[model samples]
Target chain A: MTYCVGLLVNAGMVLLSDTRTNAGLDNIATYRKMFVFEDPGERVITILTAGSLSVTQTTIARLKDAVRGPDVDAETSIMLAPTLLRVAEIIGNTLAAVRADVDEKLVAMGQGVSASMIVAGQRRGGEMRMFLIYPEGNFIEATEDTPFLQIGEHKYGKPILDRVVTPATSLADAQKAVLLSMDSTLRSNLSVGMPLDLAVIERDACRVTLRRRIEAGDPGFRAMSDAWSKALRDGFAQITL
Target chain B: MTYCVGLLVNAGMVLLSDTRTNAGLDNIATYRKMFVFEDPGERVITILTAGSLSVTQTTIARLKDAVRGPDVDAETSIMLAPTLLRVAEIIGNTLAAVRADVDEKLVAMGQGVSASMIVAGQRRGGEMRMFLIYPEGNFIEATEDTPFLQIGEHKYGKPILDRVVTPATSLADAQKAVLLSMDSTLRSNLSVGMPLDLAVIERDACRVTLRRRIEAGDPGFRAMSDAWSKALRDGFAQITL
Candidate 1:
């Protein structure tokens, strides 16, 4: 299991994901789920995945293969695509195909594959966009009315996002919102653990601006988590019955 | 589609439940899920139900018939049960029976019956107790380390309860905690709606000491919800990115 969230605000885009993957309680492992593809001043694409590792990894590998192929074209390569929407379509179709192939082989053994992803970035001359692509290859774009998209262990972290996020939020504030959202999910769910992968892409920059890894026992994250717990207790004490 | 939570603390017990039930998006109705049975000075039992309305309604009806029957005895009637555990057992058995009966009939239409419940109260000579009863007549009791039990769409409201609730929490504080928990669930889920039933049982009283119904336009609830939202936004603004 994993927890990943992506937000598109007026200033830019923020994406965060946990690195824990488990086949069972005793088989837990850490695996990075964020992948980035960028061409300095031309285009930037970030993908955050959650679900069956085999499917997501294979799909991403195939996507990279397409981008590096000798005959790379607009229809087959995400970097060569005309718009972010087309990039999402190519990724979605690839993800669906990979999942179907994996599921077919695993079905005979009473096993299956399941995966979904968040696509966020900008391309020169094109507007910034964010989408949640499903395992079935269809996707929904985040709009001004709903400026965020999340997948996996989402409910525990949703209330805070629902109350605090909006399209006009600043880039810095958007990062804080997603971090807190991930914090809530990490505390409530055992399957989702740290260290976290975080990235920020400034609007229209067509490149990644900030990328950081919050390792276990990182002071900044610890301080924020403690501060949040204290604030919640204080607020709880202040509320009248 | 419902949200019901029950908490047991040193001071007593707090139970809150919403009254919304839905057959589909187009078919929604208001139905009370909390039922109270009290012999005042001798014993008290509160049942909070969630799932198939047919199963729960039939189970409650049968339990009432048993209590009112001429041959009612300790083994057959909740009011005459010696301990809260026995009362929970009686309720659990009844629920499982009712579910099986309902499922047998609904199976012809390719439908099924599913229901679960939280039983909380105390008997005059026994200790306070709370149990979450499953559809198969099995149940798990709440302990001091984890003093809360929830059923139906529970994740959205769980983080707060996990942070604030404890066995030593005061009755007043417990009530506030459960109400806020319910408020979170109501905001995040469409199936859990307005018109809530709240009840508190004092530690050795063996009966409900406080009970109230919060209607849709209730001022107190509205004010509390608004205050909580404001506190969250203010807290978010104060945090550093």
Candidate 2:
């Protein structure tokens, strides 16, 4: 299980993901789920993935392979894609293909391959966009009405997003909403752990602007956690019979 | 879809359930999921059901029938159960049997029946206990660690419970936690809808002491909802990037 959320706000875009991946309760491991592709100053794309580590790691490795390969056309590559939509399509196709291959090999043991991703970014002159790419080579764009996308262990964190998020929100506020959302998830679910990966992309910048890693004992996060605990206690106290 | 939650605290047991039932997006209706059986001062058992409405309604109806019959016994009754544990066992066995019977008729269409329930109450001179009963006649008792149980649209509302709830929480506070939790689910899931039934049984009282129905236009609920929205917005503003 994992938790990844991406919000497209008027000022910029905020993306956050937990690094924990567990095959079982005793087999938990930390693995970065955020991937960035940058042709700096021209285009910058970030992919946050969730699900089976094998499928996620393989799909990302393949995408990196495409980036380092020859400058193929859009039909043959993700880097040459003209738009974010096309980039998402390419990612979805690759993810689906990787899943199919892995699933086939695992068939003997009756295993399965499952993975999904949040793909968001901007081209030099194109608008900042976000999408949720499914494992079946399909995707849905986040529009003004929704403005955000979440994947994996999503339900536990969804309430905060529903109550506080909107497209008109500022990038700074969006960052807190997402981090708090991730905090709520990490508290309730054992499969989602710390050492989170957070990234911010200012609209049309075509480069990563803000990036931070929140470790287990980070003071800022610790303060936020304590504040939330206090707020909940106070809030509960104020409610009447 | 449904959303039902129960909290066992030192002050009492609080049970809340939404009355919405849906076969699909196009087919939704109002169907009460909370059933209370009490012989005041002797025993009180509130069962909050989720999953197959047919299975749950039938199970409750059967239990009612047995209680109303003169031949009541531990082998065929809920009202005569010796302890809250036995009461939960009776409900679980009934749910599994009802599910199996309903499933038999739907097997040709490849459909199935299933139900889960939260049983919370006390028998005279016994402790206030809570059990989350599964469709297979198996159940788990709530501990100080978990403290509460939720069924149906659970994910959307779990964060708040994980944060502020505890075995020492007051009954009134538990009600608020559950109502806010249900409100969170209502916003995110259209399948879970209005007209909630709330029941409170004081610890060792052996019967439901208070009950309320919050309709769609209930003023008190509306006020609480608005206040919660404002609190979330304020919280978002108070946090720095």
Candidate 3:
């Protein structure tokens, strides 16, 4: 299980994901779920994945291979796509193909493989965009009314996002929103563990402005989580019955 | 769908449930999910139901018939049960039986039936108790470390309860905890809706101390929801990035 969120706010996009994976209670492991591709002033794309590690890892490997391939084109590679939407399509296709290939082998053993991802980035002159790509390859974009997308163990962390996020929210506040959102999930769900990857893309910059890997016991994250918990307790006490 | 919560606090017990029921998106209606059975000065039991309405409604009906039957005994009737645990067993068995009966009829049509319940109460001279009864009739109790049980669309309302509820929490605070919990579910889930039923049982009283049905526009409920939303937004604003 995992928890990843992608936010499309006015100041830019914020992507956060946990690094936990498990076969069951006894086989838990940490794995990075966020991937970044930046051609500086040309284009910048970030992917946050959740679900089967095999499918996501393979899909990512294929994407990287495509980037390194000599025949790279707008139609074949996310890095060369003309629009953020096309990048999502290329990634979605690759994810679906990899999942199908893996499922074919695992299905016979009574096991299965599947995965989903959040694609967020910008192309030099195009609008910044974010998408939640399904395992089947279909995708949905973040709109003004609902400026955030989340996958895996989403419910525990959703109410806060529903209340606080909007397209006009600033990058700093957006970062706080995603971090606090991840904090709620980490507390309620054991499958979503720490050492998180966080990335922030300033609007039209075509590059990630802020990137962070929050390890367990990191002072800044500890202080923020402690403060949020205390604030909730204090706020709860202040409300009249 | 439904959202019902039962809390076992030191002061007594608090049970709260939403009233919305929906067969599908276009087939939504309001129906109470909280059922209270009280023999003043003797025993007081509250049942909060969630899942297939057919199964829950039928189970409640059968339990009522058993209580009113002429040949009622300790094994056949909840009112005559020796302990709160026995009462939970009676309700669970009844629910399981009713579900099986309904499933038998629905199976031919390629449908199924199942339901879950939270049974909370106290018998005179007995300790206050709460149990979450599964569809199979197996049940688990709320202990000192975890003094709350929730059923149906539970995730949205869980974080607050997880943060604030305890066996030593006061009755006043307990009531606030549940109402606020229900408020969170209502905001996030369309299937769990307005007009909530709330009940409180004081320790050793063997009868309900307070019972109220909060309508959609009730001033007190509105105030509480408004206060909670404001508090969350304020807290979000105050947090450092």
Best by DockQ: 3
lDDT of 2: 0.88
Q: Which runs in model 2 stand beyond 4 Å of their true positions?
A: A239-241
In model 1, chain B matches the true chain B with a TM-score of: 0.98
Give the proportion of true interface contacts each model preserves, from 0 to 1.
Answer: 0.50, 0.57, 0.62
Q: Which stretches in model 3 have alpha-carbon errors above 4 Å? A: A109-111
lDDT per residue (tens digit) for residues B159-232 in model 1 = 88988999989999999898899888888789999999999999999899999999998998888888888877
Model number with the top lDDT: 1
DockQ per model, Cα = 0.71, 0.63, 0.73
Q: Can you write out model 3's per-residue Cα lDDT over B10-103, one digit (the tens) per residue?
A: 8899999999999998999999999988998899989999999999999999999889988888997888899989999999899889888989
Estimate how well candidate 1 is docked, as a DockQ score. 0.71
As for candidate 1, its clashing pairs are: none
Docking class of 2: medium
Q: TM-score of model 2 relative to the true fold?
A: 0.97
Residue A43's lDDT within candidate 1 is 97
| Interface RMSD for candidate 3 relative to the native interface | 1.0
